[model samples]
Target: MRSAKLESMIPAIDVRNLKKSYLPINRRAGGKTIALKGIDLTIKSGEFYGLLGPNGAGKTTTIGIITGLVRLDEGSVSVMGKDIISDYRFTRSKIGVSPQELTVDWFFTIERLLYFQAGYYGIRKEEVSDRIEQLLKKFGLYKKRNSKIRELSGGMKRRFQIVKALVHDPEILILDEPTAGIDVELRHMLWDYLRQLHKEGKTILLTTHYIDEAELLCERVGIINEGTIVVEGKPSELIQSLGKGSIEVYLSDCDPEKEALISGFSYVLEPYDGGSRLVFSVDEPEKSLSEIIKALSSNGCHIHEVKITKSSLEDVFISLTGRAIND
Candidate 1:
């Protein structure tokens, strides 16, 4: 019953067979670089979805195509059952994007900036002032309504970008690195507010370098690489796929015999600090740890220390991507 009810609601964003490429201005002959290669994905209504990838991973291109900023070279994109190409006017209205760049006009006051945005969407004059005030209060910016964008702190400026996006009352909000430059406290505050918004039934598509933030807020995540999606699942599920936990063993002596025994058990064993440290993943930590310790002791290997820890989203990313997000 629940699955059927959920399916009854149209997806907020859908892209299929998406392909985009760019040609360098100086080198027109065979200098084309593909951004998105036959990508297919969907974000359902009222879901907080995270899109994560390294730089040059087609994340920006995907967002650009959906927001109607970049024209797609192939495939189709739809928002709320409306095709972006055929019904872009209506599709764009349903989405509000907060880009990574500070693209707002710093000359305008907080109040006027929001009003200007609402005006672009053709919001009624009578409804404009009241709606702006309400959104400002919601984002803790009502007191700075008359303050110019330059006067506000970086955190406040970031919050205003969100308020400006919401001024249009969009059904789906797309935030690209929304909390990039903000401090930890402000990030947590914004997280709480975003959770409240999600509870109110707003669909969100977030692309961020902060893996921890994605793990905390998003229900599902899609990790893209080399112009294609490599993995898609809930954060917990993805981390679970790596293993139950990780075990780091520090040996007193570096022995090839001991190294071979540890390597035999784990597919992902790394030697750190001159082969004395052996880090590997295990499916059952309790059973595996006992077995590993026994094998080492029986083999005349001296074990100095052992530490078992749970796998994190970062570990999963590194395992899959073969590199870090910042790389």
Candidate 2:
């Protein structure tokens, strides 16, 4: 293992001008499909980063290229300062990837499966036995250690997949939709565990469709759209740049003259609930609320209720991509 000081100085993963395309199965259909369009990305050691995109946005392709599962048509990639292609073995040894799909031996017991995973990295059964046991207990799967993969529940399988990735104790973890299709409680449990791993200084690269998940867990996020990264920054900073809080005012009644008076203000307004509810987008809701209320009162407009909504990472995503992350 590299020293902490040394690891802190080098990036966990780096890609430069990455481009990839897939050939059509039949030439009669159309041209080749472009998956990635010359994207650059870097994740620092011990940092938790998120890659968020819609389906077919090249997120999985990027992860595949970095983990040596898929061949890249163009560009260079490095893992921990070593060239990924030339130093494939060294790079592969440094990463533990829990892919989105469940690809495990259904016939094998949970313990046996993890033992084989560790053995693939040249770790003996005796050497990783304690580690395996510890992981099973940590994930609440210790009682089912003897159960076969096919017998475990969906949530159990997800936990086991993460355990398999950690068996060899790699320096970096790559999770692709780790919480997809799981129950809310299990997802929260996984989040807490991932937080613990980050606290332990493990570099993590997460690809998720859940926008709020990225906003809550990731230190920085890159939003990919149409096979390219459209934006990258801290969640809070991106929200501030591209989104504005909205103030929704509910009125008892709205007349043409009152509507005209409300529309006169320098704010974006939209009508809801048959023009009785007005939504105004503003930079600062707290500072603008008093003025808006006073203006409405002086104009004989009766305010029923008011709601202030802050900008969120999801709002920023929609503003940049013009579509929801899951869409």
Candidate 3:
């Protein structure tokens, strides 16, 4: 293992020209399916980064490759400045992954399962018992410590999965849809817990279907599409660059000349409510609003009401991918 002081100077995870593909199970189905197409990504230590993409966009494949669950056809991956392949045990020890699927043993009790997981990382029960108790209490799972895995609720199981991942106290935490299929309260709880973990200097790589979650939690985000990363930046920066804000103006009367003049602006104008309203997609609505109002007033067009909408992370995702995040 590298020294903590030395590891802090390098990136938590780095990938270069990553490429992966899966062979067809049946000959008649088709040729090999490409999962990742030469993607490059880097995550800094103690940063909360989000990896977002639609289904079949290679998000899962990328996570799998980094965690060593799926092999990459071509690429180089390093964790804490060490090659993942050459330093498999060291790199794996540095990361704690909570996958979307439930892969725990059904028969084991919650506490027992955690003990077994700790042992896998060469941790003795005596050395990890305090950490296990702390995690269980922090995640609200201490009450059910004696419950079997099969007896836990969905939310409880999700919490246990996170606890299991943290049993070894890895530096990097990779969470794949950590809040999916859970209630709103539980989801918010997990979000808070993740934030706490981030504060504690955990390098978190999150993949979530919820764009709002990514926007709220991630300091920076990368959106993948069709095996490639289309965009990567701060969520606000991405929204400002790739997303469009809108201004909807309701008019007192419809006039062809005024509408034609408004359409000449750089914004894309779409008529709403049979010309009674105009929806303009503008790059900067706040800067353009007064100009638009003045233009309308000078043209003798009466304004009834106005509504402005700022761009969001979801809008950026749609603009880049041409589809919703869930699609």
> Over 4 Å off in model 2, which ranges?
1-6, 27-30, 249-265, 268-280, 284-305
Displacement of residue 213 (Cα, Å) in model 1 is 1.1
Best by lDDT: 3
Each model's TM-score, in the order given? 0.81, 0.86, 0.86
Each model's lDDT: 0.85, 0.89, 0.90
Clash pairs for candidate 2: none
In model 1, pairs of residues that clash are none
- Tell me the lDDT of model 1 at 235: 92
Highest-TM-score candidate? 3
Q: What is the Å distance of residue 188 in model 2 from its true position?
A: 1.2
Clashing pairs in 3: none
TM-score of 2: 0.86
How far off is residue 254 in model 3, in Å? 14
Per-residue lDDT tens digits for candidate 1, residues 248-322, read 887755463445565557734455565566666676566688878877767666787899987777877888899
- In the range 98-217, model 3's lDDT, one tens digit per residue, is 999977576878999999999999999999999999999999899999999788899898999999999999999999999888999999999999999999999999999999999999
The local lDDT score (0 to 100) that residue 188 gets in candidate 3 is 93
